[model samples]
Target: MAHNQFELLKQRRFLPYFVVQLLGAFNDNVFRQAIIGLLGYMAIDADDKALYTQLAPAIFILPYFLFSATAGQIAEKLEKARLIRITTAMEIAIMTIAAAGFVTQNMIVLLVALFLTGVQSTLFGPVKYSILPSVLKPEELTGGNGLVEMGTSISILIGMIAGGLIFALAGAQGPWVAGIAVIALAVAGNLTSRAIPPVGAGAPELRIQWNPIPESVRIWRLTRKQLAVRNGVLGVSWFWFVGTVLTSNLPVYAESYLGGSPTLYVFALAVFSVGVGIGSLLCEKLSARTVEIGLVPLGAFGISAFVFDLHFAQPVASMAQGLTVGGFLAQPGSARVVIDLAGIGLFAGVFVVPLFALIQSRTPKGELARVIAGMNIQNALFIVLAAGVGIGAQSLLGWTIPQLFLALAIANTLVALWIFTIVPEFFMRFLSWVLVRALYRLRVRGIEQHVPDEGPALIVCNHVSYMDALILAASIPRPVRFVMYYRIFNIPVMRWIFRTAKAIPIAGAKEDPELLRRAFEEIDAALADGQVVGVFPEGALTRDGAIAPFKNGVERILERRPVPVVPMALRGMWASMWSRRDSRLGRMRVPRRFRAHVEVVADAPVSGEQATAAALEAKVRALRGDAA
Candidate 1:
């Protein structure tokens, strides 16, 4: 049974891993923020402070470039539970070295410790992502990822707060306090890692690669083998690029543009982090417990809209002195700015969770770790580039923070459009989802369990409305190649969507005999390739709100290629705007009253040999009941 993401916390396989990851993220931020705080606020010399503050992030990110390929190979070659324990132990050792640096107040030692922390994180990256598929069922991947993302975001916010508060309050003894906290967290992380249940090596026979460069190239090539995986990797990396730009600019933006102090900056961070957590939690509900990439487009649209709004929300001039968090909140337009920031974070959460889940769900288990490694490398490169661009824009071009936000808004649109063009399935899914969500209150029963997760199957449903295929496509968890009437498939706005979705367009025998033959051949090929094919047994929508007789075409289809047939029905759709409840041209035109309640029922799959059109039609009618 599907349960809330939080319920997984009670399970043995997920809870320990979740705690370890949360601690790991917390520890990273605490150290990083403390180092930055030391330079930004405590350092006596301006030049020394500026140089190290800039160098800190670079040092942390460098290991991902140099060692992630080797990390991926190690993860593939070793047992995941043992690997996690080893990496957590490494973190403990790194924190101990860091404590020595803090005690001596030596900058060089501290920098070395920072770099080592990055290396530890690099070694753990592949193991963290690749282990989920090994331990989780496919249907659980999205919810699992949502929890991980939510936990990581909240941990970062809390860790930064703890580091800043402890360091600021303790003064000279700040490093000592920070040092103890880091070591304690590291030990806790290690202990939690030990509690994770055992998982066998994903690729035990794989040979270890010693050279990072060639191995990185090899892994990048591996990602290109599947188009969906490649697109997913690119999407995730691009998200990092955009996110780094937005987040890294926050403090400066708050001070210069928003006329706010550090407290206000912290408030902004909290809002954004909480918003992201909220959005991540909402994915399971919005997708109906499925990993629906349709949400990706909605996310992208929201991100662009909110970011553009942020530019306009900023004050025209910087105040003489920054305002406190309370003062900032007292301003008239402050709430708008908060909404914009929260919206961006919320949409970002919506955008990223599914891409990560999709990559995990689609990638081959044996090579999943390496592909994730490749994605990490790309993410590193993009983040570095984003930093450079930010620096160059501010330092060389003299652009203000609002100008930067404007540029990012424009860049987001172009990037999202390019990615959607590369993967039309995302856009098609988006259109289907929007149509269903806007026009109907959709409810479904027995879909997740009965629908085949993978493999060829014939989906037989009663034809009720012209929008039947889109509704089914939106509701079902898998991508279905709908066998649709040629004329209906070519409907204006829906035509391109149908084409992009690869919906098979067929005509009746008298209308176009060649198209009929070709459609059947294509349907056979799709089934042979292990894809779902949906068909309306009645062949056309009923003129009245009643079940029509099943056609002989369904019998012909079953005889050609016998596959399991699942019976489904869309109820209460006959009165929908898209249906001919009145007339297609008269009162029931393009836009009727929206949000009509509709229910779809899916019954158990029956063997293909026994799935005659008459039997399937009767099943659908019974399932629909008095819905019309």
Candidate 2:
């Protein structure tokens, strides 16, 4: 509510999901690292050791494919927060089983535990994702996702390192601290879970499916119907495919080619996680207030660049043996390689956060959990594909680690291309990029709560700055047609901006009254067709900082095709560098952060007649609240 970076986290609704997911990632890596480090390669044949070691990750990702659809249905039937709490409690026992396997040195039990952990994660799939739309407004989805991505990556990296270090140093007793830590994290996650507001499930009467393949296919079909949800699933799948390759093979590169101890694996993972966290945080900042998807492509470029550099970073000669963690850091040329790996992770942050939020913001109500389950199913398929590709490339194709990495990077580009091309809207974000770079980034608070995701609607906001039209065009997930003053609409550089957005130009009754009529007709057409029509009720940017009186034009337009009317207000824009008052005289007077603090707040819709000047002004004032 504060619009501060920490506000999203401090809120109880988001925190529960955040903490539970973080703890789950921590537990996963902890168990994985423990089992991975416990390998007795000397006891096994050489061929069997490689297969067994790789099997650990394969077992964990398998259940997401097998059970995500069932978990999604269960989430729809049960109370989500309570269900999540039970799942968290179950994690405690699951990790206890993991501890037993570690203590007994029973490989089969440990593998089964890996499978169980995967199943637990699969159950978590829908609750983790679907809950966001219920708790946060549309605008908040991007920031909330940014925080979640940041938390998950940081936890995984820290968890893997801690798990490996504890197991290697403390032996059987090592899992004791890990067990206690994991259970506590899960408990903490559950405590926060209670703070979340309740939301009912969609299609509660729908029968649950026992079979995953058929059910996954069915859910996948459901996801396809929702464009945004479909893209979300694809993006999540791509993430797993890329992650699987990097995680599965990097250990071999570090050990066999780079000639390093097990610590090198830690180093590789740490670098990647740091990159992802940084990229995730950057999404909130780069996207401004709403979900600006342009950054996804920017992240794609970073992935290609650093991943390519990493492939080429390999030395022609072998390195010295037995490098400690510190020694690895101290090695010649190691720093650049580490930084490159970290860069890959950072951009991954940018790539994934938006896609997740896009799904949350766009999925149908009550079905959020089911859609998340659908996403998990896609993730599983990608992971399996990643496994097959990794194995075949390394064992059959005889590709070197560096060559394999290069191929993966190429694969990333191809995958991104395929997904974006299928869903052009993701790449249709080019307009967003143009708008942000053209001026300072715009911020909005609760705007999404105001705009109806579907049905007919008219949004009336008082225009203040020249950039108002562009800002409105860029931020809203729904494509809108803004009614702007004809004079500015025809200006050379400004004309292109208006043209790009397909804004309708209107003049006052005293000047080109016909254009005004045409504008109303257009608004009518848009509303009748169930699209949003955005208009500056004053019919022009306010010459004064205070909102100008609303014109009957909005009332007239609404009368023609009466629909829901949503009111929006822009604050701090009067002081923006692009404002009329912010001409050459005031250019040097504004503070640096002044531009950043401006916000557009949205209020709930009112009836068309109730959208009179006085009523509209009151709504705007309410949205702005008391300044500061």
- TM per model? 0.92, 0.82
Q: Per-model C-alpha lDDT, please?
A: 0.86, 0.75
For candidate 2, lDDT tens digit of each residue in 1-628? Answer: 5274469778766765777788788878877776666664125676766787778777887888778889988988887777887787777777777767766667787788789888888888788778777777666677888888889889988888877776567765664655565556656766766666666665678788888779888887877887666876787788888888888787777777666787777777788888888889888777765677667777776887888888888543236666666776676778777888889999889888888887776677667778888878777778888889988987999998789889988888887887767666566564546555554546666665668867788888877878777676666756678888898789777776576556889898889889877888887888887788888887677676777777778778866777888888777777675667665664545574244456777888888755676687678767756531
Best by TM-score: 1
Q: Weakest 10 consecutive residues, lDDT, candidate 2?
A: 586-595
- The runs of at least 3 residues in candidate 2 whose Cα sits more than 4 Å from the true structure, single-residue gaps closed, are 41-48, 172-197, 256-259, 314-318, 441-457, 462-467, 474-532, 537-552, 560-607, 613-628
Q: lDDT tens string, model 1, 413-476?
A: 9989988988887887788777878889888887776888778999988887878998888677
| Model 1 whole-model lDDT (C-alpha atoms) | 0.86
In terms of lDDT, model 2 sits at: 0.75
**Clashing residue pairs in candidate 1, if any?**
none
